[model samples]
Target: MRRNQRQAALVCVTNQYSCERLILAGKNLALSEGLELKVLCVQPPEYASGSYLAEIEYLFAVSRRAGAEMIVYYRDDPVRAAVTFIHANRIAHIVLGGVPDPAGSAF
Candidate 1:
């Protein structure tokens, strides 16, 4: 990456609580020098009512204004989607809001 190139980070928010946490985390990441924050709101297959998309977009804009580029990914299973996105985009970091038990939790 060039000096002007920004490092990208994705934050996966799977729930209301997670979304709030992810926003705060994204803001912090945005403040870092040359880092871009992407807030991805993961909606389940049935619960995707399109209400959170705008919120996600708004957060992305805020991140951009904070000196980092902002983007939003609204999809089923935001975590998995974000992982795929990062791999495709060669993102450097993934900032998860909380610790999840892989064995107990199904993604």
Candidate 2:
């Protein structure tokens, strides 16, 4: 990718905690590619009752230290929200956690 492009490396987290690794990965990838780092979390509206506020704040701090901004989107369809965010932010790289399903389960 060109250095002058407005591209970003996005780290997608599923919850408010356990995101340090993702953030670090995004930071390293962004630094190597000359891109900006971004952190994203998508959750259902019901989970927005502030129950995980502290954890979210902590993740925000981690992201800040990693030179990335953490953004949270409350939506029923996480895939759609993430897609929109990617398009809006001109994301060039994405880092996320997942495990293979031997049975090919579908969400």
Candidate 3:
């Protein structure tokens, strides 16, 4: 958290529209505050089959095109894994809306 160092902003998205909104807001915030932008999409364990893998790739490309580094991961318990990802990355701010917090955790 040094003055010269940049904080990271995490944008959690489930749908295309939300992802687009996050991209716009994330980029603007990053530009304004000099923070790094990261987009995270966590797929449920049940949806981790090959069929969904394609969507993951598509999202990855889309997020990158929107000007954020993207990370896609799978877990039976995404809440826990997302917490881990947030902590491990030392994210300073998180962007999300209308999405309920996972049952066992708060974000």
Q: How many steric overlaps are in each model, in order? A: 0, 0, 0
Clashes of 3: 0
- By descending TM-score, how would the candidates be arranged? 2, 3, 1
- Point out the worst 10-residue segment of candidate 2 by lDDT: 1-10
Local accuracy of candidate 1 as per-residue lDDT tens digits, 1-107: 35555566666555453356565676676566345666555556555566666665565555555444444444666668666767666456666665778788766
Give candidates' CA RMSD values in order: 6.0, 4.9, 6.2
For model 1 the TM-score comes to: 0.54
- List ranges where model 3 is wrong by over 4 Å: 1-5, 15-18, 53-55, 99-107
Q: List the candidates ranked by lDDT, beginning with the highest.
A: 2, 3, 1
Q: lDDT values of the candidates?
A: 0.59, 0.87, 0.73
Best by lDDT: 2
The Cα RMSD of model 3 versus the native structure comes to 6.2
